[model samples]
Target: MKKYIPLLFGDTRSIVGVGLRACPKRATTIGSCPYVRMRSLKYSIWVLIMGLMTFFTTPASAALDIEITRGVVRSIPIAIVPFDVNNPNNPNDIARIISNDLNHSGQFQVMPQSRLPQQPHDADAVSADLWKTLGLDDLVIGSATLTDNGQTKADMTLLDLFHSNQSTPTVLMRQSYTVANSQTRALAHHISDIIYEKLTGEKGVFSTRLAYVTVEPLPNNPRHKRYSLMISDVDGHNAKPLLTSTQPIMSPDWSPDGRSVAYVSFETKLPQIFTSDVATGQRRLISSFAGINGAPSFSPDSRSLAVALSMGRTNPNIYIIDLGSGRLTQLTDDAAINTEPSWAPDGQSLLFTSDRGGAPQIYSIDLAGRQVHRVTYLGAYNASAMYLPGSSTKISLLHRDDRGFNIAIYDLQSGTMQTLTQGGYIESPSPAPNGRMIVYSTNVGGRRMLGMVSSNGQVNIRLPEVSGDAQAPAWSPY
Candidate 1:
């Protein structure tokens, strides 16, 4: 008899087994039947011990397991040489930032800086043979120089080692930028954009920003929690509070131009829509309708806002408020709850969450047609639908299944739904400006933190704040 045991890890699968054969009835003195039985028993015991060890050694709830549900089969291989800086105390590690951005995308594997045989500041100095010896597909080298005008001048060159035919590597891209000392980080992100686009043929979102809500316990007032609206780089750096309130702040949406944000705040003991300019620290109340005023989303044109307002009704309806005139036009007049309105990339339609069908589901309403059509049917619960960047055919949203609320993407063209996360509690999915990644909130050991997932359900990342809870991430447009 033969017994087989299967082991599974990611997409990898293997089997371990031992065959037990009856000992020969007539055995020579050199090879006894008793010896055969003892050997078979030892093999069986060894297999059992190994299987138990594997089962116990595997982390059941590892963060990387988030992609076990679905992950990119292949990630691009690239190297980022340490950027040559005129001063050791420059305080800006541009190459590291670029490397982190590409790594976080889960689409590229960056070679470690220590593994490089030499540091090259430009294409002229890059040793094609040395890097090629390491078998890297791509290589990036750059330099940052301090200018007499107190600004920084940065130059980056990307080399395609795969295309190199001679001692010199092929130049895939080369770019130069001048920015103030304070904006050096932004310059690095722009360089990442150039590298990502040249390699993936899709726009990169490394230069984009993220807007999220953070909550912390107030000292001397244990009963009250301070809610803050935070703006930061996509990697969770340079976090600054846009507004802080004792009350809650919810549903943040970035303006089309990425200069301002619209969100629902409870500053006046009631939910109201407010828009704040990122540069000027200016804020304006956009909606204070009689009933609920929530889920404010900016129109693509930036001239109007699509919001959910109850208007003293039993259920909230979709409304479009002209930012200039404050004119309000109701888009949905249903008695059922219609909220969480997000605009299409074209701004001609809106996708919102509604409970008209007895289940919370997503629906679409064309501004001109005024016809509401159901968009989700996979699960009994679906909400928070937003269009992926540079895509109208797909949207990332919250979905509920047996596990709980998780992030999932719905293909409008294929009518197929695929989940991207496995957290027990997950919500508020905001896609990156380039539409290749998503950031959402998840419950991690009773505390709320941010998580990111690639659009293809690969590359899961967690962003946990050191002192507070982060939720409702809204990615800025490039």
Candidate 2:
């Protein structure tokens, strides 16, 4: 196996042992995955490693805000010292992306240590008074060194300033990863994962990937458009286009294994269901059903796709197709426009939008022909339902109010709902891999911009914009 530091992700990098080469514009390929066969052994070892990392620190990465009137209400201020590279292969490595990730989480107040009153190498340094004066709660010192065997390892540590009563406990964490120079950004993401969980208590989705659509205006007329299907990192790093066309692309949902994505593309001048390989960028039409073949969603098993297809069937219906066998089964057959289908947490039932009553509202249905029920009674117009991915039971929808469209969450049990986004013409609410946040698109200053919202609707911010208006945000499973 070859060893290299991969830097394909301009802003993100990772060092990995050979056999993990770039599939080109895709994710790392753990070839033959020798470890796949040793499932139990891998699980045991991963559990042990993560357990140790947890003991050293707790980072609060959840979307829910904690009312810490007494304890630690303010984030533990931490200084992220630029990694001391023995010999940095890339002279232009910027920690900006990683810093942005930490700040976006809102759990850590990061201060650049290069300007610290007193800089220290490890946790045991003589800078307590300086950090306190600067209102810093902790410090992080990290460095990278290439081993003799032609591999790179980044070592990082966390230091907590001992306050009188509100002092943070000493939590130390170290993680070592290998790369082929091409993966430096990925390596940095690994460091982010460690620091995020260490300080936030919740696992960091920093290492996770993202799927989105990039829109460009035509040369002659700005009103007309061109859109490209893109997938990249959660921090908008390493973006690679999946498909480009003159029409709009929507609903890019990743499969369970992160191997493929099910989305609706209009390359043929009409909406159609398509699946593309995450590793190969290969695409295939899964459904071009006569009329309204759009909004494709994957089942929990990834074996089937619950698609909104009309097939000239009066109202848009929910149909399931076995991806492996191409066996199509109709899940809903109604004339009231049953569309925007999303599977339940347990995969036993599906939640979707319907007007079987009067206005568009959310409804639930089972495949066994058991029964169908209405889920959402709030909001006169609700469409495009998306369930929070990764072990979440709450479902989200694109809700239309007197004030443009905002994202809202529905609790099936209490029948309570939380309106997440406000005052932004928001749409396409796709949950991040960690389930703590959702990435969506909203009109900002009359321009469409990508925005992320905390699951509980606390932290809301827009991502960097592209040349044109952006819409249809999707978070990747990986």
Candidate 3:
């Protein structure tokens, strides 16, 4: 008989044959173990659930370096002139922020700063002919000046170079904002959202936030590590810790209104669920069940949470907890592991991972009827499923195939699957609000880093951490 040992390096599915035992009564040090091929499908799922309890802690920094691994073949060509500033040495460049925002979306190709024919802060000073000659469709010009009240005044105008047989560019839009110096970055992201919507007709996620877990070894004691739940801008800037502890934090899911974040914390040396306010550091205990209290997902209304609980049993079942009354409603009672509950956009039903069919797969249960049905059949292992924004028929999930575990999009109607990332070690995929991109944690050079991939599989961007590993990224809603 093979002895069950825990693997403590990366995501649950990516590392094959290795798994962690679930519902430990005390906090114990987790270490790497030799590969033990899974014997049965139930055992495979048991391994996956147990792995969720294994966390490798890192330090407390939010600065991430971005690298674009893939790009779209054809992107819209545009140029953003360096905004004129009274203090030329100012570090916050509004124009540069907008440029990076658009470029990172894989929808726009921004012109290099050195290639611009001219730099104009005002719309009237721009020569449309010069830009048209360079085969550009759109141009953005802006200026930022410091006000006497210690506020920054920024102005921007969007100009269309290809205005139907006209030599003069059409003024698409003009806007201005006067805010505190500290809010200049926020203003830039807001402006980027406007420009992106005006051009693409879809709302931009530039102003959204992301909630994730970060950990690093302690300074005095190399053996102990600090774990923190961090919130940062979508671009991975202005990161601040919401909660920090020596214990493990895992599986952060943002509320639809973007006010609270629900996550699993092992601070008491036992697993518990708590919700923390994004603006305030205030926390409210959600669950402290007997055996296992893990995988907390907020419903669409943000009033209740769908979670997985063992309830002092060996295998976990799905349950819902009302945030107001503390009422518990059990959804699944079975011998198989039913975890990773993701709510549909409507909140009338939930999609969860289960091994009832002898293998892990995506399954859905209606709340009113308590009916269970399998949703994914294309793969033997499909978990961590979430409804892709703007479409109920499609879902983004973790799929395991011959290439190893990767992010994939599964269509419920046609039964088709489209793999997004080529990397075998990818997990915890959270789709952007606009359905344009999916952010997930990936293993790079043996370090867990945050990465994003376009829904169509054209673009892949890696957000590498400055110090230790960043895992379990949950993209906030707009």
Predicted structure with the largest lDDT when compared to the true one: 3
lDDT of each: 0.78, 0.66, 0.81
Screening candidate 1 with a backbone cut-off below 3 angstroms (N, C-alpha, C), the clashing residue pairs are none
Superposed by TM-score, candidate 1 places the C-alpha of residue 33 at a distance from the truth, in angstroms, of: 60
lDDT of 2 by residue, 355-472 (tens): 8889999888977773898777777988777777655557778888777788888776787878877754788888876777788887867887777777766456566556676678
For model 2, state the Cα shift of residue 371 in Å.
1.3
Alpha carbon RMSD to native, model 3: 15.3
Task: Name the TM-score of candidate 3.
Answer: 0.85
Return whichever of 2 and 3 wins on TM-score.
3
What's the TM for model 1? 0.83
- Candidate 3 has an lDDT of 0.81
Task: Give the poorly placed runs of model 1, Cα more than 4 Å off.
Answer: 1-73, 85-91, 147-149, 464-466
- Poorest stretch of ten by lDDT in candidate 1: 1-10
223-294: candidate 1 lDDT, tens digit per residue: 899999999888787889999999999988999899999999999889999999998879998998888998
